[model samples]
Target: MNAVWFVRSRQINRSISWWLAITGYKTSDRSFSNRIYFVYLVIFFAIWGLTVLALVTSTVAEGLQAFDPARPVWLAAQITVVVFLAWWLWSLFEASRRSPIKFTEEDAALICATPAPRPAVAFAWLVSAWFTTGLLFWALAITLGFARAEIAVGGNPTWADAPFYLSAAGQLLLPVILLHLGMLAVVWAFGCLRLNGYHSQGSLNRYPLALGFIFTAGLVFGGFEGIFFQSMAWPASAPVLSGSGLANYLPGNLAGLAWAGLGMGALYLASRRLNLSRAAQETSLSGRLQAASILGDQKLAASIHLKQRLKSGSRPFPLPGRPGALALSWKQILQSVRAFGAGALYNWSIVFALSLAVLLAPNWGVRGVAALFWIAQLHARLTQSLRLDLDQWPLFQALPIRSSYKLLAEIAPPGVLAVLVGWAGIAIASLLAPGINLWGAALLLPLVIFDLACGAAWDVFRQARAELLLAGMAPSPSFLSLVLSGLILILFLLPFIFFNAGLEAVLVALLWGGGACYLLFSLASRSMRKLGK
Candidate 1:
């Protein structure tokens, strides 16, 4: 146990040192680069702090306006229930598939070779995993506590006044944090059992899956009952917002915390029975996956994940018998299918959800959120096929096809899919939401197409440059290159900025999108051709 702690401490120190070195810091000497890095970080944090503070202030103000003082308990309970349900389902799914306790390849190798106690190693890894995974949640909870301070004592308070409300905020925050940790403890317990090979045998293998199915069905039925009863307005129907005093809620919260603490205690006792060798074997790929993620090489991480998934007896899609560009398209489409089952349909569903949200939004805030969600999803999905193609650039380049043809073939499947989904989402949203503007809905077709083309073009350019860096031919693209690309995109989108979503805007977008797609495709082809040379 002591040895495990020592190893973990040394690992943490090594990681910190590696990060510092990467950021141009040296323990031996102070240099100009260190100062530059220090200034950059200071400026970055200054900007980030200001932006976060403003956003939190606005969010808190909005929330407090709609907050019901009589139902604080109800709100907290609802949040707790939602978080538990999500974590429960996720834990079951992940444990059924793989071990939740992860180690780096190095750590796994060391633990497997040594006489270290399995329970202590698992506990250490569990804590490390929980902290790493829960950091974002912890941050959000802390921010909420900070924001709640404004309304803590029933007045708008400045930063100096916030301290007065710290007691109230802490009351809210402590339980929330404990609840999250408790949920993670439960998950780790289940994961340890899975890793120890307890759940691998024939009958027990399907036990988790059966439970997951039952849970899903029960959830669906309960939701239906709630909605049905609420809509019928039965006298006994539970109110959506109901609460009691904080004093009444406190006992139940304490009871829940006690239960979780007991579970954690049991987990440590049971960990001694775990199979360290099996655990290490199961998590071998996970270490590589985590290493790739830590190094900011998401593409590498994704590729590793895909390969892992394929190792479960699933083969790649067979190649098309046709030659030239058709073969490239088939390869891209197959890769997409194998990497993400029905991913195109999933993307479509997201776009539809966003579109519906936009139309049904009662305020600019909701609409803005919907738009942001769409943009984030669009950026990721639009480049899916192109990234896959770029990964195997040499194979595609060697094909007996023109560069332009190859580029067109690679982009066509995903680009067309994106435009189709976007258009369908908008059209269906218009039908479902009669209040939306007909002209705006109609004009969105071209705009969506234009957005897809622009996203693909930019992604291709960015990824192609990264490929060059990976191949040792060039350094990564500079800030200037990024600025120039943005300028070019703005120029293309300039005409639509001033016009309303009308016939004129539609015509402009259609022409611009078509021309831009052609030009960008040609540029990509030319750039890619220079790869081998």
Candidate 2:
């Protein structure tokens, strides 16, 4: 067997398996208890996924069997699926350009000096892409296929046909796999084009602006319009990917399967034309990012990644005020944009575009929960700014500014933007289905933001305290950061668990929001006292 065969058949599969095993829980080096917990968690999730697949599979199969499919809902589902698939593919393409096919330092040391290294390296790329892209499609198919599942179920209270979704999901799995192979082929071709200087990599980063704008506008506008307008043509015909309407073609036929196979094979051959040294350097970039993540320096990893995407424009924003930490906030906000340009914009657009998903959800409760979850994740990203600032704690203390002003400045812009972004999701949801629940979303989100801002400040403060408190002790598990964030989230959400949306609920939320703000303020001030702020 060739060296590539050995790596692919034995070495790489073991590495991939070991990666999956550890990544779902913790690193391989983590304690036995962590690994055990991770295993239980995986098993539980696996069972839950299978249960869901089972429950819906039969319904899906039945839906597919009908020669004449259901109309508007199905079309909407199809559109959402197509749009999201496009979005995911676009994301993968941008990411690949930023970090094209390459070998790691370890892989290069061990593998690159060998005979015919390019084929092995290319095969490894194809292999990793197979797992990642295949997994992505599996997730999207289940999710998008179930987007309108309730409507499909149609109040049928019977278990007789409830067990077929798994079988159907399994059947669709091949087409899904093929679909991602097609995507990888496209992205890989683009990477090759960039590598050969046929196209600038930065062009891949910039050209997404128009697409992002359309996606954002569609999610915000079409999202509401879809609910109001219902269908362009009610009882619209079912889309066929092969006989296309909105690109829902699945490789259910031999011809389609053959085409998909050929596309992937052709891309692999194309990638084989890549310059090994250049590809090796690109792969090293990926390795550095992965290592940074593994070492718990995600922010640094993100920064390194942005450097590769490499946006232009070093010009500063006009002074927001007389310019104290406002200057810092403005700079950070701009740097996040200018450093990664299209990559950053594309991500933010995706965040807003999720209003489409929110609109598609069956109920306001689902919308509220999803919005809050999105908001919190974005909030956590924003919170990293505080952590970044605290990295130079002595600089902050040495500044001429008062402690309270400094603290407020740190929280203001990003915190407000986080709140605004969260509400955009709600606004779309509300437009689709106007209801009292909007009150809950509108009220609840700001309170959560307030709580998060406080928590982030407190995280910085606690770190400072920890330095003074337990300077000699090693830090706790990585999960503890998540635990801290979750605790803060639960604190804010606690008031929400009992109260239904009403005049009383709104009144209570207002009072709670007010009291929470006051409390957070007091805490922030007290915490600031540590640095004599």
Candidate 3:
């Protein structure tokens, strides 16, 4: 028994070490050039700047909520927490469906074959991977949570209060952790059921699967929201963690925390009843997300989804709305649609949610800066199609088509798609915050979309320049190139911010975005063609 425990611990430890090494730091032993070191220095400073920026944002959020101190702060927190769970549930559904867990594929057959209980070993692996990967994220969260908590207390926390803030954050995490654990265990159990052909299986069985997903997502949403209801009693019980105090008002208070732990434990124990045939299947959203982050460009990440078209032999369908550039635009739009999934138009919904948050948020200037940060992210997603064309630049160049035509076609699809989705987001956001001028919101959406598309296309140019600078001169797609590309994006987006109502802002954005689009795509096109020469 002791030996089994030792082996399990060892496996968990090794996995943790390997994941941390890969994700947290550079892994290659190869010598770096001076330019590489310069990139590292820039990243180091950028991380520090971001940390300070987050703390400042949190503090400002606290001040803004002070306007209506009674309900708004807690409401914002509830929304923040609920939105996250919604996204988590969505990702969980997609992840399990796309890549069903197969234990043998992960080389975990030895653990299953051992005397140690298969379920026990599996749970250990799950908890270890979850903890190791999530630790950094949680650490970051602690800072923001602390800032928010200080607001709850109607006080500003100082450096000396760090320990207290961290303790509060830890206490806050307990029930939430249990809630997440239960969610995960239930999902895993469902996976096991699928392994046995219980639900969401077989052809034409998708309706049942879809229903189950919606139902499950709703349950999680309701559960998390319920857990945070205690926040209703805040300020009254805002301090004490011992009993019937502020701790109880937090999302995962002690009683709820205990129940969640027990529920999750029961779920894991229940998994022991399953038949583990030499192996079981597993794939995770964490892996794909981490890969996308490491790749540092959405195009590289988006490529993974492009190869997933169901009818490989069939050609793309035309977009009747875009007759002039339909042939050029249709494939990109279809690919974005397919890759992003049905019922949702690209990631505009997420941007909308963020925009809503920005609108509700109090600090205009800081929030503008934060919006730029969010725009930087949206720009990454927008650029995926642009990068797709850039990747096959040699092929595009080899054709007899003029460079101007190639550039126009490449940028049009992504921009058109962005406008449609961005408008969807704007419409939804308008519904959420009725204070918004519908006319102004409608007018601003296209400029916002255009800005996002142009920024992304610009990244393709930045990357092309980097590769050209380092090509034959150094390695393929060097780290410095990604760093340089990101720096350029940061510089470009610094001036663009949200306007709840304005034609001036919109016009300015259109001019800047259009000019940047033309200039960068043309430069990138010319640079990419040079690669073939």
Most accurate candidate by TM-score: 1
**TM-score rank order:** 1, 2, 3
Error of 2 at 392 (Å): 4.4
Better of 1 and 3 by lDDT: 1
Candidate 2: worst 10 consecutive residues by lDDT? Answer: 233-242
**lDDT by residue (tens digit), candidate 3, 1-533:** 55445665776666545654543433343456644764775688667854674466466556647654765445445444544345445535653454223343234455445566646654655665456434543543444456555665557556676666656566545544554454455555544444442344434235335645654555466542454333532221232222212334544354445544664565466456544542343333234544565657454344444444443665645555544345456666676556666423436566656655544456777656656554655565566555555555544446565655655676566567566655665677677777866554455555555544544554455445435433321113333434444444443344445542356555655566557556656665565455432
Which is superior by lDDT, 2 or 3? 2
Q: In model 1, which regions exceed 4 Å deviation?
A: 14-93, 133-152, 156-164, 171-183, 197-261, 286-295, 313-320, 340-387, 402-404, 411-530
Off by over 4 Å in 3: 1-121, 132-167, 197-244, 247-257, 273-293, 309-533
Worst 10 residues of 1 by lDDT: 235-244
Ordered list by lDDT, greatest first: 1, 2, 3
lDDT of 1 by residue, 1-533 (tens): 39888888777667767777775666455688777777886698666864575467456545644775654434443443445445655775686566667666777678767888877877777766667766655545445455455545455566776554455445555555565566677666766666663546334347557655654565467642355423432211121111112334455456447645865875676576676677677788888897889998866776788788788675545765466567776666666667665545676688667756756778977876776566556545655555555555555556778766765675566657766776676677777776776554445455444444454444455445545735533223334334444444455446657686556766776677567656665665677566543
Look at candidate 3 and tell me the lDDT of residue 1.
Answer: 56
Better of 1 and 3 by TM-score: 1
How much does candidate 1 score in TM-score?
Answer: 0.61
On the 0 to 100 scale, the lDDT of residue 155 in model 1 is 50
Quote the positional error of residue 39 for candidate 1 in Å.
16
Report lDDT (CA) for all predictions: 0.59, 0.57, 0.51
